[model samples]
Structures are given as structure tokens and as C-alpha cells.
Target chain A: MDNPNLGGEPGSLSPGITVLIPAYNEAESISDTVNSLLAQTVQPAAIIVVDDCSTDGTAEVARAAGATVVRPPKNTGSKAGAQNFALPLVETVWTMAIDADTTLAFDAVEKLMVALDEKEVAAASGFVVPRYVRTVWERGRYVEYLFAFSFLKPVQDFFGKPLIASGCFSAYRTDALRALGGWSNRTMTEDIDLTWRFYFAGWQVRFVPDAVSYPIEPHDFKFMRKQLRRWSHGFVQNVRLHWRRVLAVPTLRMIVAVAAWDAMVASLALVVLLPLMIVLFSAPILMVAYVADLPVVLAPILLGAIRRRETARALASIPGFLVLRAVNAFFLLEAIWSELIVGRPLRLYEKGH
Target chain B: MGIPVITAISVIFYILMALTILPILRAVQAIRRSPRGAGRPHVFPLPVLAFLMLIGIVGGAWVVATLAVYRLAEVVPNVRGLLPADGAEFVLLGIGAVSMVGTLILVLSAVEVLSWFCAEREPKHARGPDGQKVRPTDLIQGGVHSGRPHG
Candidate 1:
């Protein structure tokens, strides 16, 4: 079949861009995702969705939407495994990774290409806005994502170390990705790991804020917790794997910020101590003491909320988002302690993805 | 010296040890049942394992020390009320902390096993007519479906 996006006869021109979607049991969303791709202004040379042995008719829906589907012999692993399945199939110079439940904006692909074409850019990751956020938890996540995408990522890019590339809409220069040995199959947050790997290899990644994709957020607390726990564990694992790079370049603002914040937040002593501070000290005294340390404690949260207005509103609902942050903090501490002190191999799937 | 102290110490130690052993036993059983070399057991590096063991030991010691303090308080009339009404709360907190740490270790070990298994059994490479790895782009053009289709 001739691809109109390549700007020539099918056989005459090489595939310039290939979009890969890693899917598993996404029957409800696959068709719309494929249709969105089909409706792209600058279409991909081809679309390949790697079905990770979904019992649902995800493969059939993808096929009907005009995407070529490939199912692995066995469920190889998780999202990373599915992407690895599609890596060998990409014949294009650039490959875009889009989640099955996400819909890309019409110009997302074109903008990604433009960003990748820039000098020294190894990969281009786009912004993800939550498509359906019905519950309070989902709304909170929507806010968190905005801060991550808009403020934090851009700041990280300026420092030359982007922490994560949203899996929903990320593009990679094939050569750079292949040289880095594709994606690590063992990690849950492969996109984050890959971003760090590219950074360590001295490859520059760009944040294309204009390139957008709408992804489904968890509608309830249970699903939200599962997602956050997986992400928290994955973040901890990646830190263990790349602590050397982080330590070597201690001057990077984002690195310093993450280390400082994570250390303070994850200290079990701090959580237990904070409540004690309230109990042992008078409320007035505690409030004064906290105010004295307000900048450090409240900076990330307030800045995070301001940058993501939707998230700010979501944070307002729970009165403090303390439970969310505390649970997330606990998991982060657990992950770090497990990997570093307990000599545990970071398990990505035990939390039941 | 008394039975109550010894009983408390033994019960606490046994519970801690069992918590540690359960996951390790499950992991070892999993490794043994898999076909030989089908999956490698996930093991923390020696240095890392040593560090974790040290933490576990220190944590275990803290539990013993707390129990010893409580026992001493019980035996000595002068220091009996020194710990205050929240004494039990502190003891519970200590146990809870140690249990959480132990649980984290178990989870880490489990993840290591699963990661090793997944890496070992990655899908076979799809080869082309030239014996080169088949590119997805090529397969799409060739229109030949190869691999077992899912039901």
C-alpha cells in the first residue's frame, strides 16, 4: 500500500516515520486511537500496534482501523516488552511510541518530526493531557501531569536531563534508540529509563509542548494507587541504576532538586517525627517552626499546583492531598529501602499493574 | 530471666524470622520448579545482600532492645511508670516499622525473580528471507502473516 505521508511512490521512497502503539486489552480505545492516527495531518509511513496477548479483540479492532497488528508468542512482559516486540519492525528513521488508550492531536506527529530534525536532538517527547478524568483522584493526577509536563520537564530540558518522556506521545530517532539497545524490558517505566539512558549517552531530548496526546487517567483511587506505586517503584529502580550519572553531575538543578526532595520526603523518621513535632510541640510552636521551613516543604507543592491549574483544583478537593502524597512518599521510601538496603531486585509487576 | 521475657523475645524473633523466610522460600520453590536454566533465580549482588542483611540485623536488634527495655521496666518498680501511657504505642510503632522494612525486602526479591524470568524468555527474533531480522515495515509490505495468532 502506498503511504501518502512519505511524499512519493511507496516502493520509491523509504519509510520516513513509523508510529508504534503498544496495546494490551485495549479493545474499547484501539479503534479511536487508530482513527486519530489516520486523521493525522502528516501521516506516518505505517502504524504498527504490538498486541501483548490481549484476550479482548484489541488486535481485530486495530486491524480494522488500518493498523498492522503483531502479537507476541507469549505475553513477553509489560509495556516495555511490547515496545521491544515492535523495535525490530521499525524501518523508518524516526519512530513514535503512542499508548493504545491515547489519541494524538493532528499535528503531533509533524511537530515531533520537526523537533527531531533539530540539531543534536536525539528524541522528542510530547505533552499528554488526560482525556477522561471523572473522579477526584483522576482530576488530581491531571494536575500532577500538567506540572510534570509543563514546568518540570521544560526545566529539566534546560538542564539537559529530562526525567521522563511521556509514553503516550514520544518520538525517537531510530539510530539513537537502536544504539542504546532499544528499550530495557525489565523496567516498568521504560520511557523514563530510556530518557535517562539517552541523556547519559549525551543525546539531547526535546520537549515539544505543542505536540499533544489525550490519554485516559485512572478514574478511581485504587487504579490511581496502582499506577502511582508502579511509577514510584520504577522511579526508585531507575535511580539505583543511574545514581552514578546523577552523582557525577551534581550541579544539575533537577538532579539536586529530586535528590534533596526525595531524601527529605522518603525519610520514615520524618513522617513519624512530623506528627511528633505536632504532638510534642504546641500547635502554635509547630506552625511557627513549619513556617520557618515553609519554602522547602511547600515550594514543590505550591509551584506544582500553580503550574497545573487543573491539578490545583483537584488538590483542593481532598483538603490537602496529604493521604495521596503520604502514601506515594511511603511507597517511594519502601522502594528505595528495598533496593538499596534490603538488596532487593526492583520488581515492577508485583504491584499488579 | 523469667518466662514472660523469654517467651516475648522468642515469639517476636520467630515472627520476624518467618516473615523473612516466607518470601525467600517461595522464590526458591519457584526457581526449582522451573525447567533447569529456563529461568534464573533473581539474586541481589553479594555486596548489596550484605548491606540488606546488616540493615535487617540492626532492625532485629532494635526489636530485641525495645522488648528488653519493656521487660526491664516491668521487673523494676522504680522505672515501671517511666515510659508513660504511650509506651505500648511506641512498641507497636517499632514493630510496624520493622515489618514494613521486611515486606519491602520481600517485594524486591520477588521483582528480581520475575525480571530475570522475563529477560530469559524474550520473544524469538522474527527473521526475513535473507536471514536478517524481519523489519515490521517489511512485514507490512510483504502482507505475510507469520506467528501464531491469538484466539
Candidate 2:
């Protein structure tokens, strides 16, 4: 599996790899991200940061940190468009999609290449750890990453389809990516959408737990709520687009089954129950009734605790997390209703804080 | 018993629903018709539809309630008598009139929001190196600033 002609030698360097960072108003973190990439052991041939018309000096910071900055005409609606805008500019054989707010490990690129080479994989996604986990919301997201990276992704991979490849850190074989018409500009969850598309196009995606990238997690309630809302809307949008694909592909059966179960049972359950929980807490009698039903509810929590001790600790932030979840569910329900009944697309904007 | 009044209310409700539902239907159809793998439509029409539906249901209920009160006034002799001696019937009519107007405004606003949603644009074309219809990657020359030194 060696290509000596394309600067590839056995246990030697391969062709240049391009790290594309799509940034939108990430002035606070762009410099650090660039610096981290500069320090990488397997240095990227180019670091292209697509600044989507940031009003702030995000492009400047990226430039100062030694990334080649390309500014879009305006915010092109999403990160997908930004990548699409920069795809032609990338000359490297491999491209790594790195978020502007995320800092990659020094060995991240090397580790990804090892996985890609060994498995003959078309794409590989690395682990995303939260940069600051001091806050409750951040801690919850840390647990979420653990569940995703350690448990869920493995399960998804075993089923022959990975549900989501985080946009924070993912490497792709340039040819394979370009052949799929690049990322779809219309999708909010383009990362997840592209992963599925790549899989369907006969490309296997490997998960490299060692190739770590640290992304800033939402530290406050408002930010967390907005983040969750965007994620929920994106999830709905992705599901709507891929529902037919999952049905058409036999290999995707288990993955589709698990996703359906999660969407229907877990997502809907949280949405319905959160609102009810709020209402119940407002009433003394209903609160007492809920307390009596605690055993039924606590069983799942207890089981989760036994299975994943770290997750149990994270779940202690349940009150705040539930509030965020309820907010997200409200937006998700609205988005779903709009998509299913009204026949409209879902719009998720990161307009304000 | 007033046929004209009932007819007017029903017409308004239908009109409201039509104004609210038509654009959303159009947006949805557009999304369905668009190419596959393009991603979720911009959710342009749904939010508007949902908002309108909420207002229509709530406002319609309020209108119905007011109409019911008027009917009560007509049915119960004591209730009619308890009303203001002068122009009390007109006052009840005025309340219904205001409610109907309010409903119309609510429906109209919903339509406005829906229109805004539908107006959202899709991603524009990616330009090439020669200012032609090009792939997105052509914009990157010499692999994104090769001359720049690493930090």
C-alpha cells in the first residue's frame, strides 16, 4: 500500500497534506489553532484558513499564526460552503478539515496517515476533547465526546457506518473527497452528511482515537442552548436527507436502525419529557408523583453510572443539562414539524452569541 | 342566527389559513423538487407555517369565544337585558369586530414571516481560477501561502 512516486516511501513521508480550517469570527482561538498546527510533528504542506467574511480580525490572527487566509465574499451560510470554496486551492493529496477553534495534537496528522495507510481508508476522523472543562456545560460535553469517541463511534463503525465524523478534526483522501462533488453546501451537518456519502461511495472511514483535537466547549447556558439548537436542527436536516439512503443500502441497516431508535426513542423522549418535567416541577402534587416514579427513571441513570463512571459524574450536571436539552428540544420539534408537515428546509444560524 | 356574520367569520378563517399555508406549501415543494444530497432546505417556510398555525388556532379560538358570548346574549333574555340600555348590542358587535381584526393582523404577520423564510438563498456558484465556472479548490494557489513562514 505504498506509492513511492507520489513522495510515498515505506515508513517514509507521503505527498503533502493540506489542513483546511474554515473560520467564521473565531478571533479568540484562530491564533492558538494555527500555532498548534505549526507545532505538529507531521507538518502540513499548507494551512488554508477560509475566513467566511468575519467582521472581527479572525483572518488577521490566522495570517499572523502563519496560515494562508482566504476570505469568502460573505458568510456563505455554512462551513461546507467555506470548504467548497477552498477545495480547489488545496493541492495536497490529503486534506484535513480542522475547525478554527480547535487545536490539534502534534502527532495528529501522522496518526491519521498511519490509520489511512494501514486500513486503506478514504477518510479518518480524530478524537475531539474539550479544551476547557471547568464549567458544567463543558464537562457534560466532555462526557458526550467520551461516549461518542469511545463507545458510540465503535458501535457505529461495527455496523459499517459511522453516524457522525466531527467537523473539528477529520482527514480525507483528496481524490475521494473531490470525486463526491465535495461537501454539499445546503446541509447544516455537512460533516455527518459527507461521512455517509463517502461510505456509500465505497470509502471506509477509520477513527483514530490518538489523533486528538481540543475544541472549545460551550461554557455558559445561553451558548450551550444555542449550540444544542444548531446541532438538533442539523440532526433533523441530516436525517431527512439520508433517510432514503439508509433504506436503499443494505450495509447501512444496523446503523440506520440505531439512528432511528435514537431519534425516535431518545430524542423524542427527551423533548416530550423535558417540557413535562418543567410543568410537573411547578406543581407540588405532580412533583411528589415524579418522586415516586424516581425508581423507574433512576434505573437508567444508575445503569449508565455503572457502565461509565465518568458519564455518571457528568450526569450530576443534569439539572442545567436538562434545561439546555429542553431548549434544544423545543427548537428541534419546531424544526422537525416545519420540515415534515410544512415541507420547508431547516435554518440554523449562529447569528448572535 | 346571523348568516352574514357567520359567513364572514368562516371566510376570514379560511383566508387566514390560505395565506399561512400557501407559501409554506410552495417552499416545501421547492425543497422536494431540489436535487438530492443538497442538504436540508433552509427551513424558510416551516417556521412561518408553524407560527401562523399557532396564531390561527389561538386567534380563531378567541374569535369563536367572542361569537359564543354574542350568541349567549341573544339566547338568554336576562343576559340581553343586563347589557347597557343604549347600544349594548352594538358594543358586543364591536368586541367581535375587534377580535376579527386582530385575527386578520395575526394571520398577516405569519404570512410575512413565511415570506422571509422562503426568500433565503442557496449557496452561490463556486468560481474558478480564470474567473470561470470552477471547482472550489482552484482558488487555492500554491497550496495556501507557501511563501509565509510557519509560526
Candidate 3:
């Protein structure tokens, strides 16, 4: 789709949206993030990188990359805080919150904008794929995203509510986002929070699976642990906070509840129940029971990855996903135990690499 | 084991089962190779050595004694000569431990292989405008660098 009318000339592209990237010490990726947005097929009218008190020259790098730099007077510790800090400066009818570490497909914005024609659609997100898939953590995330976006997202979209308008690469109706106070910092996950609020405000969220965004997934175990912890805590926090209000929407409530239940069961099974069974029953052969799940998980990945390149990558990454599942289970159980049983709410917001 | 069911359904099921084994094989191979980032050798963390120590000690004992119990017994027909004169439960314990240790190693290998895969790949080359090669810092407008200096 040609956006010739949406050219870079000032006052040329009327009602054109702006890109807002929130960054903190992302000097390495800031330029690439901005450049990718600038190179989009449906080019945004403006790109603003909100620097959240970086020790590095993030602001200068962003400015050099053609993104107008906006820094809070003081450090906005969390990603949501930084995005909210720059929300007022957004003048366009539509605005996108692209993370500094993410790059999008050339036609991502073009595809995302397609769903917004329905006036009720408040937000649209593209599929998320990892930029770097070399590391175990990265490969695991690659498969995780592949399964979630390719399989789960389509089903969620059919029911008219995506689990989230993923934070990394999503466009929002400027007014609708502002109405919810521009990504609440009440939870560690602003994306989930904002998406639920949009539904609560009677706005629809769409997921365009074809529009892909590649963000750097965590590579190291330390980084992965931090990310998983934040994610687990954020999920529980949102569930605890939104459960009362979200129950009003039947489809969303059912989906969220089921997902939560499944996660709990699966986590317990992998990390606790299975091991306990093996020890108690002296069942060494039962250990292979995990092998049964291989096809169930890999089928969707292979189906999603029709291309030769993606198929090979998916095949290579399957083991990593198994590792990730155990890690996820461990973290989820820890989060639930800490938050629900121990009555210790996870209040810290640590950004994933 | 059961009836010889050679229908298309069984054939397809076997084919899928065979395909699933490919990933398990690849995972085994990945951990065997030393990981490299860019052109440099990547060292496995100290924890890998720690895991290997446990597996080696436990697996080594089981393999040695199990060999004595099974292999020697088959050849000599006198297991007590090789192993201690023990209860039948001891024999069961030896076999069970061997299988359990074998399975444990497989599980741990999958994790170690992933750790190798998860190590960060070094950036190939920093790029300048119009697709020209540039210094890493030059790619960033402010000349900010994160790692050991490179192209």
C-alpha cells in the first residue's frame, strides 16, 4: 500500500500518526529502532524517542537517528512511566509505542493501520519475533512468540479481544489511549493493563499476525530470569487487579481465567508434580511422558513456519522452548506463591533485555 | 506388542513420531559442540562442570557396577563373584539407579545445550549510512559504545 500522501514534508500528511519509542540506556539499539520506523512502508509522520534518564548518550543517539528526543526532567524508572511522560507531546490522531530494542517489518504499520478503519478498534499490534535467535533464551522466546502469535492470537482475535496489544510494536487511537491515562503504572505490564482498559472502555483491540516486529529477546540466563520474574509478577498483578472488573466481559474473562488456570497447572506439573511422581513411584519410564507434548507444541510451530528458513530455525529452537517451559513454570510458581500465599506483592518493575 | 495394524493412520503416526526424534537428536549434538560467539570461543559456565561432576560420579558408578552385574554375569554365570553377595533388592536397586541416572543425564544435557545456544552472538559489523561499513560507535549518533571496541 503506497502512502505517497503520507510523505515526510511538513503539513503534507494530514492526521498522520507519530512513533513514540521509550528508551533507557538503549544507545546500541536506539538508532536501529528509529531507523526501522523511518524506513516503514507506511512511514510515520514523526518519530519521538523518550529517553528515561540514560547514563549513556541515548538522547543524542536518538536525535542523530532522526527521532526527536524527549527526556523526563527526572528519571522515569519504569517503561510505562516514560511512555506516559511523553504521551502529552503526542499530537497526531494516532501514535505508536515502539520499544527501543524492537524493529518492525517494512509493512508493519501499513498492516496495523488496516484494522483501525473500524472506529471502535482502539489499538492494533503486530506479531512479535525475536531479532536475535542465537542464544538459548532467544531461541526459546522465538518459539514461544511463534506459538502465541501464530496460533493463540488468531483464536483470540476471532473472539474480538486479543490477550494484549503487545507493547513492543502496537499503534493506538491517540484519544482512546489518553482516556485511560496513557498506560497505567499500577502493574509491571503496561501493555496488558492498557489492552484490558481499552476493552473496559468499550474499545476493540486487533492483532494483525502478518505484521511482524523483531525485538531482541533475552539471551543470558540472568536477563531471562529477570524478565520471567517481571512477567510472572505482572500477570498475577493484572489478574488480581482486573479480575473483578474484567469478569463483566464474558469472552475475555473466560480466556484470561482459563489461561491462568492452565499456566498454574502446567507450571506445577513440570517443576513439582512430575518430579514428585517419579521419586514417589520409582517410575523412571514415566519421565518420557514429557515427550508426548513435543508434537502438540511443534505442530503449530511448523504450521506457522511454512518458509524454509523459519522451519529450520523453529526445528533448532524446540529444545530451547523445553528449557524455557521449565523456567517459566518455576517462575510462575514462585510468583503465585509470593503474591497469593505469602501476601508479598512484587512491586519492583525491572525491564527485560 | 499388539495387533499388527499397518493402516495409513499407523504409518502417518510413525512418520510423525520419527520426525519428533530429529529435534532430540539436534539437541544432543548442540550441547556436544563448544559454543562460539561471532568468531571467538565461548566457555561453558562453571555450573556445567558442576553438573558434569555429579552425572559422571553417579553414572560412572552405575555403568561400572551394572556392567559387572549384567555383562560379567552373562559371561561367567556367577554374579556374586563379581559383585558382593547381596539381596535380590540390591540387584533391583542397581538396575533402577542405572536407568534413572541415564534419564537424568539426558534431561541435563538438554539444559546445557540451551545454555550454549543462549550465549550472545557478537555483532558482525557496524554499519554507516547508505550501507557502508562503519565503527560501532559511529552507528550510534552520540558515539556511545557498550562492549569491547570493534568495527
Candidate 4:
């Protein structure tokens, strides 16, 4: 095969990393994303952009910025579909999925590649911090990522499983990805679907904190709703889909159980019970339960901020976090009701940001 | 508040923090010893210690309140007959019941989701990303082809 997408001969690329950017109408941000990959400490074998029939000249911009562009005959409808279109062309040993709106730290690829040195690791994901943190939604996600990546994720990793190797910037062994048939579109979040599948197959996925990627998060309520709805439904759908196989994986089972409990019970406590108590018991103090976990949440945020020297920025974002948490609780409850009770699952792949 | 009441609350706060944060410290030690984590600078940060303490305090308070309620119920003649004799045993029983219920829900949901998966069959003409029709074997074999709409 000519393998024109790659430089030199196919499979001859050293370090063996082929980057896949599944894009649709991402001309505005696609150049920066591709440029970031080009400037990596460990240059990728090829940066292939699967232009999912974007009318905005996304393919042109990416091609201009040194990426090999391929367009699908039709709009693939989801990121997974677009990636799958480009999967067969990956001649390198490792296949990485990077969101069109995300950029990586200069050494991000270098850091993440270390974990793939371990044969057991089928896929590895880096730490993700929002690229811009000015808007309320962005700020809220900034704090949320800091807390999750710093605290919960490490514990999960220590137990030999990190929940989901985040979708935005994760690398997988090409063989592993092909054997599993690429990312699945059956669930709202293909990344979670793929990660759980990896677990069931007895393959390991890793979380590399040193390797960091910055993804542009939803900056306003309009975009946040699209992102949160998909995420909430994705989570519930995965639990329903993988609950059987999950029972055999000890760490994963415990993680899912606690997550489900918290998602269902804690959301009820915050969204419904808290308001009901305040109204019926005439005890406004019960509202304190809404922000009771703030101190604990802040602990991880502060640590993550201190490492990045953004303590003040993190502290200023605390209010945003609280607001986002409340909003998250409501969406989770809605998703549970919609998927489990109403039997209506979200099937559209709307752009999150 | 009276000085005594303020002092008592402070004391309880510290106790809760201690109980919760202590286990985290132990976990950190184990992580530091692991081959992958040895000498990692941020293994045990102060915020984690502080956060765990806060969680401990909140969780401990809940446990304490539950035990207190049990004690209160025992003193009431009407409710006294309802709870088991030992307050500790009663709390354990409550915990076991909740766990059992949660487990049952998980198992039932798993069965439901699996049945749905089993019954789900793609239409004869559904084309996958590569322009090939998705097969039923692909579904059971983990991930060869996915025909559903993406989210």
C-alpha cells in the first residue's frame, strides 16, 4: 500500500504514534489543534484529520497546517464514526484520538507514551484541563476536572483501573483498537463505552497525570446543556450496558456502585430533598447541605491549582463549581428518569462546545 | 453560643476530621510504595489530607447521628419495641439491608440491559462507517461494528 497519509514508508515512523482528529465544522479551532500536535516533543508518525463532510473548509485548514485530511462520503454523525473512517489507515503501532477543539501540552505525548511501554496497557489518557476558563461553565468544568483528576482518578488508578480513559486525548494500541472494532456509537459517550469494553476484555487502561491536554469546554449554559445531557445519559447507559461484566472486575464494580449510589441518592438529596425540607420544615439551614461538600471539593482543587500555580484562579472559581454541581445533580436525575423510567435514550451527536 | 457548647463542637469537628483523613494517609503511603508511583512529588498533597478530613467529619457525623437516633428510639416505649436490642447490631442491620437493596437493583438493571442488547438487531440494510452491513456477531464479539446512531 502507498500509505500516502504517513511520511516516508508506512509502519516506518519511529515512536509509532498516529494521531486521529475527528472533526466537523471545526475550521476555527482545527488549525491550533493540529499545530499543537506538530509541535509535540515526540512528533507523531502522522496527524490524520477525518473531515466528516464539514462545509466550513475544516479539511482545507487542517491540510494547510500539515495534517493529512480525508473526508467521509457522508457526515458520520458521531466522533466515533469519523475516527473509524480513519482507523484502517493507521499504520503506526499506537493510535491516538484527539478532539478537534483540544490541544496538548508540548510534552503531553512524550509523557503518555511512557505508560504504553507496559505491554498490559492497551490505552492511556492524559490529564485534561479546559483550554479557556473565563465563562461560568468553563470555570465550573475547570474545577471539576482538577478535583477529579487530582483526587478520585488517582485512587481509581491505584486500584489498577481509572474510570474512563478520557475521550478527548487518549492513545490506544492499534491492534487493540482494531480488534475491538473501533469506538462504538451505541452509547452517548463512545469513550466510556470503549473503556468498559477494554476492562471486560481484561485489557488495562491508564491515566497519566503528567501528560496534560487542554480542551475547550462549553462556555455558556446553551453549550453546557448539550455536553452535560450527553455525559449524564452516557454514564447511566454504560452502567446499564456493562453492569453484568462489571460485576467480575472488583475495582470497577466498586467504582460503579459508589458512582451510581452517589448519582441517584446524592442528587435526590441535593435537588429534591433539600428544597422539600426547606419548604416543609421551614428550615433554611438545610440549604447548607447544598454546599456542604465544598471544603472537601476545594481541597483537591487547591492542590491541582497549586501544582499549576493557579490557586487564586481556582479559589475564585469555587462559586462556579457549586452552581455547576447543583446543575449536574438535576441533569443526572433527569437522565435517570429519561433512560430508566421513560425508556427514552438520547441518540443524536450534537457538538458539545 | 455558650463557651462549653462551642468547645464541644470544635472537639467533634477535629475528631471527625481525624477519623476520615487518617485512612487517606495510609492509602497515600501504599501508593508511594508502588513501583509506578515511587518518588512521585504530588502523591500526598495537603489538600487531599484536608479534603479527606472534611469528608471524615461529615461521614462521622452521619454515623454518630444514626447511632444517636437508635439510642433515642430505645428510650421511647412505642418505638423501643421496633428496633433490635443492640444499637450497633441495629445499625449493621440497616447497612446490610441498604447494601442488599442496592445490589439487587444493580443485578436487575444488568439483566434488563443485557436482554435489551440481546434483542437488539440491526436492520438488513444498515451500513456501518466502512459501508459494510453490521453483523450480529460483531455486536457479541465486543466491537467489530456498531450500527446505532452516535450521541
Better structure of 1 and 4 per TM-score: 4
Give the winner by TM-score.
4
Which residue window of length 10 is worst by lDDT in model 2 chain A?
Answer: A1-10
Per-candidate fnat, comma-separated: 0.00, 0.00, 0.00, 0.02
Per-model chain B TM-scores are 0.36, 0.33, 0.30, 0.28
Give one digit per residue, the lDDT tens place, for model 2 in A232-256.
6677777677765545455454454
TM-score per prediction, in order, is 0.61, 0.59, 0.69, 0.76
Task: DockQ each candidate and list the results.
Answer: 0.01, 0.01, 0.01, 0.05
Q: Which stretches of candidate 3 lie over 4 Å from their true place?
A: A1-14, B1-151
Off-target runs (Cα >4 Å) in candidate 4 are A1-15, B1-10, B18-151
A1-353 per-residue lDDT for model 3 (tens digits):
11112213222334878888999999999999988888989989889889999989999999999989988899877888888877777777788999999998888898888877678889999999899999888999999888888667765765677889998999998877776677877887889988998998899998887688999989999899999998888888898888766766656875676567546765776788668866875644335444434544565578677632589889999889988988998999998898888999877887788
Error of 2 at B35 (Å): 40
Please report how far candidate 4 places residue A265 from its true position, in Å. Answer: 0.8
| Model 3 C-alpha lDDT per residue in residues B17-40, reported as the tens digit of each score | 444434432332343232212221
Clash list (residue pairs), candidate 3: A135-B117, A135-B118, A136-B117, A136-B118
Best by lDDT: 4
What i-RMS does every model get? 18.0, 19.1, 18.7, 8.5
The model with the greatest DockQ is: 4
> Which runs of model 2 end up more than 4 angstroms from their true locations?
A1-14, A118-120, A273-328, A351-353, B1-151
lDDT of 4 by residue, A1-353 (tens): 11223223433434589999999999999999999999999999999999999999999999999999999899999988898889888888899999999999999999899888887889999899999999888889999999898778877777778889999999998777776778888888999988988888889998888899999999999999999999999999998888777766766876776678768877777788668856875544344455544544566678779989999989888888888988999999999999999999988988888
Question: How many clashes does each candidate structure show, in the order listed?
Answer: 3, 10, 4, 1
Instruction: For model 1, state the Cα shift of residue A329 in Å.
Output: 1.5
